[model samples]
Target: MTVQFYINKFQALKPDKSSGHAKPHKVCLLLAVIEQIEQGFITTNKVIYNDNLKSRFTYYFEQLQQGNDKDTPYLPFYHLQTSGFWHLDVKPEYQEEFSALKAASNSNISRYVSFAYFDEELFDYLKSPATRHALKDALIHNLDSLEVQYQRWALSIGKSEKTVKNYVGALKGSISNWLYDAGISKENVLSIGSYAQYSVVASKALQIEEFRAKNTTGNGMYSAALKSYQSFLADVTQVNVKDDIDKILNDENTTATEKSTLVNTRIGQGAFRDKLIQYWQGCALTRYNKMQFLIASHIKPWASADDKERLDPNNGLLLLANIDKAFDLGYITFTEKGKIVISPYLDDYQVLGISKNMGVNLNQQHQDYLAYHREVTFKK
Candidate 1:
């Protein structure tokens, strides 16, 4: 595959940033380098001489050189060299076995590539079991196509067919073992006609297994598995399964209610818990840390909102008891810039005690949420 393809995939994984330190570009370049190395497109020896590789490296290095005022210089070159990219120095004869061992070891070199250029939080998330599994599934599904592309590339670079076959076999075996461990069945593995097909199946299996794990119930894994299978059908087949699932869950006519019960229990528990965790057990507006004092106050009232709007964190706030009550009653509100807005009925003394004590100046980060509250939730 061309460098652009890898760049696009890596970009999808990046967290959305409006401004500030441009950490994503560094990460993108680092992953691109590792990807090239893994596919044997660039070796430690060749990297120093290749004009394309040098140009890419120079772009990131220049950004770093610009200093912290404009962008944080997350220098990844030293980390990359130290963390095994340099080991591509292993003779071409041993390259096949080495690549196989590297993949099978689950050293998470790709994640390390990310770490060399991003923040600690991203590194931690990538190492997380859920995220790691997702990435592995994606990589496994793409491995065959990558290998084929690499073969064509190697031929252009004057590599022999024997070496190419050996490299491809090693990559396949390593990735196959990874998929098997992630719950893909041997039958499905054997049925695949090509590496690309195998990858698609493995990706589906991982998604289904993840969804099921998060939704398991007394009816057994089978029911949750079926739900996940249905979701995959909706995604791959584009059949709009949400309405179908919703109808079953909401059907007043159903005498048999297993599907409805499972759907409600899963959606309520999974989504609510995720929202609570994201807000870090506090009220967003009041900065209320006490669990009992905080409520996950929805921006749009629950009854009036759709499922997507109701669950959005941007549409939710952590508010303390009295503040939440005041907000709901429109007795007090926040400005579009995040400053507290007391209702006309509230005296200055009361506003001073609450809003001022809380240091409620509107910072840039909270502006959007404040705007939403001002436009949609705040009382006049």
Candidate 2:
């Protein structure tokens, strides 16, 4: 009935562990439900088995599911009843069938269950952002163990124990200390709901007085730690972007014509995005380090580039959303020497966060791309 009680329940979900890693179905389902609630889909206590819910569930599944884990939303939908909070309302005529069922399948659940609802107290707790964040943090804390496994792997690959320890300690210590200063939990800052918060904390934590004092090796110590952490995150959290694109191209569900259109829309998703992320390490023009908020923008417009030029990392600039929009629409460009070149017509460039002081780092490889952008993409 209480928020802490539900948080405890979420943290202790009994997921299948026959596989080396716990199957992600139940947790992914919970995350999907929370997202739906946040997006106003689950307005009341009733939870419907709708397309939006299924789509979100599958999205999380793709992100979290590892070897041999199949996408089965129906399993969690029917089985979360055993968790003591999720209750299913089976139809009147199929009550006997629902009761007799040992396991659930999509077809049977569709036929027997009308909807699912949370226990009333639990539903009210979920509606509040703070409690929702707490619940999500509790669920995602499961990933902390995976970080341990990553450390072991790092050792196996000949990384020095001290080096690895400092890397881990730098990230964990800095973030936890920063959060404590901000009145959030001082411990387990690693599982703080989303990657955006983690990146933001890491950025702010770099400036903590204690950290600055100890970072006597210039930017080497903490910068190396942050990069290693980023690599670890990409390994555990992301699928190979190129492989994902190839799957879409090879899917039998889409015709060649449709595939062409789809591939164009997916231009930024391939190795280009990964390269930009690695190259910029953060936004090209700002201190914001949230990866999710950054856009991998091509300096030369994609439509104008040949195949070789389109995927080239040097042709890209990792930018914040507003900067990406302005650059894409030809309201802004940059000079060969990496200076900002705002279009004369864009009178309120300041409103778009485009300051006169803004510039990017450029090298010889970027010259051709910058020239093309200034000549063709710049408005004036």
Candidate 3:
């Protein structure tokens, strides 16, 4: 449906001329939209004649433009209504007027026909990266835009195509939107390997395909990649497990004292918060003093605790959720000596907004739990 549909439909493009060259202008415009889709640029289907389309059309036009031919962007852009792959969208008031001129020649068609769309099947087929590339190959192979040598050259190299497309997408497409001052290149990011290997692609493959995490928990590559990407960004690994204490507390076999101290509503989660509110007025890591934004995250972890340890206010550290999630997931841990110990797995701690000076004031009792977490749970 993908390759055959494009070839058959595109090869049938009726040239306005009775003589020399058959300009593949409609195909070129279709290629422009396909390029936009592949780069994650266009969200919706309507190809509005806005700045985006104008710029894309110009880029493709320059690449495909040939000898003695003037820049006629509006030519096939309007005339493609005859082709099965595209149709014009005019205003309701212009419906009668539009239908009358639907079969007009290049010069007769108005530039005011500002919107066009791909047929539904053609649009859906172009959504896949691999399929999109194959279709482009078919277009150029049958009736090319550029010279055959340049087309073959583009198809031959891994580095050159990768590098050029990376630069183009970054400068003018969805990558620009994605990177938005993030100060990282898609080339460098793609070279980062499995961890951050484009979350969007991994997400679609994993969600629909039921991909599993390699050497880790959860289903799909996402479980691993997302955590890895986050770790890559934040410089520490994270484990997204359900709250184990909640599971233990719900067990009927669990003793009342154990259950009592683990329930969030039953003086467990709130009581720890109350104690922390009294003891430390700010987060240990950033000294961020907003109580509303702080969490009473555990040092020893609740599932590992006995009743006394579970209820002990001193066992918890007041950290912001940003820091707390990191602490909770073992990206960052504290020493018995109260110094912040970031995991070695992290690439750059600064990227995570974690200051080098992060620490907590600890007593003799808090030191014991910190030691256990540092040894057993810390990503180290």
- Ten residues in sequence with the least summed lDDT for candidate 3: 233-242
Judged by lDDT against the true structure, how good is candidate 2? Answer: 0.71
**Whose TM-score is greatest here?**
2
lDDT rank order: 2, 3, 1
Q: What digit string (tens of lDDT, one per residue) describes model 1 on residues 40-126?
A: 344333333233343434333332221232222223332233332222233445555545653322232322322222223333333
Q: Which runs in model 3 stand beyond 4 Å of their true positions?
A: 1-249, 253-261, 265-268
Question: All candidates' TM-scores?
Answer: 0.27, 0.53, 0.38
Candidate 2: lDDT of 337?
Answer: 80
lDDT of 3 by residue, 121-235 (tens): 7777778654654565555433432223232222221113443343333223433233433433344332322223344443433343223332134332234433333333222
Cα distance off (Å), candidate 2, residue 342: 28
TM-score of 2: 0.53
User: Where does candidate 1 stray beyond 4 Å?
Assistant: 1-270, 347-353, 357-372
lDDT of 2 by residue, 1-380 (tens): 77999989988887887887778788888877876676455789888886557766765665566668887899999888889999998899999988999888988988888899999998888888667767876776553364574464344333457877876786677646655776644656434444445566667666677656666654567766665555444433322332344565678987875555445434444456778898899999885787766777888876677656766889888887667767876777888788888777454567567788888888899999989888888878
Q: How close is candidate 1 to the true structure, as a TM-score?
A: 0.27
**What lDDT would each prediction earn against the true structure?**
0.41, 0.71, 0.56
